[model samples]
Target chain A: MKGLLLKDFLMIKGNVRSVLLFLVVFCLIALEGNDFLLFVPALISFMMFMTTFSYDEYNKWDPYAITLAVKRKEIVFAKYLGSFILLFFSLIITFLVALGIGIYNQNFDLQKTFTLLLGCGASILFLQDIVYPLFIKFGVEKGRIGLFVGIFLLSFLLGWILKNVSISIPQDIYSFVVSYLPWILAVFLLILTIGSYEISKKIYTKKEF
Target chain B: MKKILEVKKLKKSYGDFVLGPVDGSFPGGVIVGLIGENGAGKTTFIKSLLKILQAEGEIQFFSNKKEDIGVVLDNSFFPEILTAEDIHKIMKNIYKNWDSSLFFSYLEKFSLPKNKAIKNLSKGMRKKLEIVTALSHHPKFLILDEPTSGLDPVVRKEVLDLFLDFIQDEDHTILLSTHITSDLEHIADYILFLDKGKVVLEETRDVIMDTYGILKCGKDEFSKISKEDVWRYSESRYGYEILVKDRDKIKKKYPNMIVDKITLEDLMVFVVKGRIL
Candidate 1:
């Protein structure tokens, strides 16, 4: 299991262009002050995760990889675990950078820094929850189209709800929502991850290969 | 003595091509050659064994676990960005008995650069790497599909010798599928020839060689042989070359006719032609 994880990590390392792209994007986000920097880790981690799926598709490696003793569930779980691991590391690195910038700008809000990480992580996890199953079922080629469309619809729905419902929540309540949002998202993602894994496993298990 | 692999009533169809429950079994301790023409479903059958195709069939190994089966497909298993070392790490975790020491030894023997990315290696080198990996696992059954398609004779011989050495254990069996029939003439114990979607012939190499013969005779003498035993018949200016399964019977009946030795390639040609000899 550790060997498989190491292989995935090395695969990510070997693909220089994708890693370089993440680094470039991270450096660019650093110039936007501390607020944007908070999302850097999530963005980079998601980028790495998304690219792995694409790489697998482009190379047609999944059919061969799954043939090994590694179950389809493990493949699916590994992706989720790997993504989160990368996400966590990226979050730590970006938070430190954001802190440095916050100090430089004299707007060092540790609370906001924590909130941003929490919010970004939650949103990305939800996206991961949704995208993982899509990739597993439809594969990377056509599945990606659905991913884009789904994300678009999700963003649109969120925008509409925010625009129409202007409930005047107190600041304390808003802070409460922000603090618990990750937990709520994490719980939802956990359920979705397990559900998605089962569905993917069923699809993969019955798959002819 | 036991069946190592059994594919029963396996059925797969493309728009035009179809392979049937290619009922066949690989018993332990022999090299089986799956011979077929282009698009004759040789690779398809092999892929089905490895479950590469989403086809309907039941494929079971003699052992409860499939880890004992090592598959070396025609193409590179890993992507170009990966080096041999990376594959070793991945395979070590996947196979229960992955011998890293043996794998490295093969790498050294094959002179494959351990650090070079697979994408940078030539086709032969990449294939060699896959074979090295396949062998190092100590799999009891080695399933090779078109492993020696376009290589020079020298490399093909080397690979064949490697396979010969692999089956030294009585428990080891090899299922090699190839279009190059001549390459398998010496090593293959049993032959399974596929044509179109169906199996044309499956028999021991010696039985096929000893039983089948090409009889050269005039058009008049050809009518004397039974059509059931005649596989294929070709004509020329002077006479006809007929491939007969019961060569001795045909010879005894037509003593005057010239009975020549037949090769596996000849049998394949005649069988695929679907003609009476």
Candidate 2:
């Protein structure tokens, strides 16, 4: 696992300058005011994460990786863990940004902002659980289409709730759901991530080169 | 002699192509060359042995501890964007016995630039880096697929010398799959010849060189030699060039007949592709 992580770090290191540049440019534009900018770093990190898969496919690196002292299980775990690390950093930066926005507005509400950021981060990480397993089962080229479909569904679902469902709910009901929905979904996705890991292990173990 | 590696009925099939259901072994302290034609399952067999591909077989290697066995694959492994320095860091974490000083020495010796991205390096430089990385940790058994394929004669000779030097230790063994039979002629102690999916022949190199011969004689002289002694033959303007499996027997039977020396290239070409004339 250590070796795989080291290799991935080296893999990621080469792309760091570009990814960080994306973050820097998008971050400045975001500062003017757009909650969407918060996702730019996480999204770029996610794409960077997928590039590692392409690298493995490029020259048959995974089979060679296995010949080292590592196991297939460790390689699967590293992908999940590396993405988690990326998301975790994205959130930390998001948290600092949220705090700055709250301070500047002077209507600081820590609980409300944290819940929104947590929910957004959790949802992206959740999609990764499904998409990563798909990536493992198929190469990144096939998985790319599946990822976009999932993203469209998420957007449609969010649009529907905002346009139809949320408006119909009573004031108290809206507050209650908003206060607790992120926690509930976070727990659900955590269980699903475990399932993803198991499924990925089965696929990766059966894969020949 | 104690066996360093052994395979029993190893087999792999992909659609129309099949590899193995063949068997062979590498006893300790020798270099074994695996020679075959283009479609002859050389890469598949090597990949199967490394467990890189799923295959059916009983294979016991390096006492079943895979880390003690090093491998040089035909394709690239490390990401192309990373430099050799990055690989050094990655390998330090991968192998327990990875010797940085040794690896660095090879980098300097091979003239491989330390910081250049692998994508930018020429093919020969990339190959040297791969071989250097595979050999950095002192492995008991080494397996290489087409190790000398694209190299120029000079560097190929140097790399072959390095491989020959690697086996100076009595326990070190190498299983090299290559089409360049000439490379093996100088260093290989044994030759494992594969045709189609099966091992057509596996014998000590010295023994094969000493016993195998190409007999060149016209119709009258060729008729005198018994048919059973021939492995394969081709009709030539001068005569029939027959590859004799047991030159000593023919030499003894026809005292006046010249038993010529056989090159590994001639030996493989005859057995695998030649038709009996």
Candidate 3:
């Protein structure tokens, strides 16, 4: 596991643009008057993780990786964990910078902004949990296209539902959903990820090269 | 002797090309050369053994009491950005017996700078890096596909020597596939030749070397030998040159036949695409 992590870091180190983009987004979010930019860093981090994985897949290194003694379970977990770690750190930086910007601007509200940022971050994690399995099962090329398209369509449909429905009953629905959705999605996708790992293991074991 | 690697009735299909239900085995302490022309299922066979493609077969591996096999292929293991050190770390997690010290030592022996990224290295250096990592693990079996293809003779010789070092142990076994038959002629104990997705010849190197003979005969004398015995014959200014599988029979039948030593390449040509007499 340590070896796999070290290797991942080393390979990612070659792509300096990713880190630079992370920083650029972090700074951009810090300066934004609204809390919208906070979500950008997390989204970018997740996408960067996806991109790194895509690069690995394109080169056909997965079979060699499995031969190294690391189980399929660990490979999937490491990727998920790596993305989360990067997201966590990027959020912290964005939060701190946003706080600094709030103090500088003298009009920013820390409490409300932090709340929005947290909600957005959790939603990103939820989306990732669902998308990762697709990537694993179908590979990044077609899976990525399907993922983004699905997300866009789902978001659009949700927007249509929110806009058309005149039910004025629940103001706490956003917080309610945000609070429970990530946990539910995480547990469900964790199970799905495990199943994906088993499939990957079976596929790899049968593969000849 | 323990069986280091075995492949039984392995079959794989790629659209139009089909790699058979081919069965072969390699015992410990022997080097097996998998020789075939381009697109003759050499890579497919190696891939099948490594389980790199989905195939139906039984592949058993001995050594470390596990199916732990080392793979030394072309420059396809590490991506362009990862360094040797990075690869060392990655592989340590993959191989229970991965020895970092051994890996670095092999890298140093090859004069490969550990800090330099893989993409920056020359082709020969990249190949050396792949070999270093593949051999670092204490694997009992190795599947090397085209390890010596497209390299200068000097470097090829060096890599060949490394392969020799790999099988120095009595328990180690290797299936080295290449079109460069001469490189393996000296070390290979057994040779399996594949022509068109089929095993055309499978025998000990000594038997192959002993069996086939290139004979020089006058045009008139060529008529004396049986046409079935002639694998391929060529007409030259001096006379007729021919390849015969059963050289002893021909010599006994035609005592005046000028028989010469045949190389593995000669045998392959005659067996594969050689012009019939």
Best candidate (score: DockQ): 2
- Candidate 2: segments with Cα more than 4 A from true spot: A104-108, A149-179, B255-257
After best superposition, candidate 1 residue B139: deviation in angstroms? 0.8
Q: Candidate 1's interface RMSD, please? A: 2.4
Q: State which docking tier applies to candidate 1.
A: acceptable
lDDT of 2 at B1: 65
Off by over 4 Å in 1: A15-34, A154-179, B14-17, B54-57, B236-239
The most accurate candidate by TM-score is 2
Instruction: Give the per-residue lDDT of model 1 (tens digit) for A180-204.
Output: 7768777877887778677767766
Residue A146 lDDT (model 3): 84
Q: State how far residue A45 of model 3 sits from its true place (Å).
A: 1.4
Cα RMSD for candidates in order: 3.1, 3.0, 3.6
Instruction: Order the candidate numbers by TM-score, best to worst.
Output: 2, 1, 3
Docking level of model 2: medium
The window of 10 residues in a row where model 2 chain A has the poorest summed lDDT is: A36-45
- lDDT per residue (tens digit) for residues A100-206 in model 2: 76677666678766776776677678778889988888888888788788889999999988888745668998898777886678778889999999999999988
State each model's CA lDDT, in order: 0.79, 0.84, 0.75
Candidates in order, TM-scores: namely 0.89, 0.92, 0.85
- Better candidate number, 2 or 3, judged by TM-score: 2
**Candidate closer to the true structure by DockQ (higher is better), 2 or 3:** 2
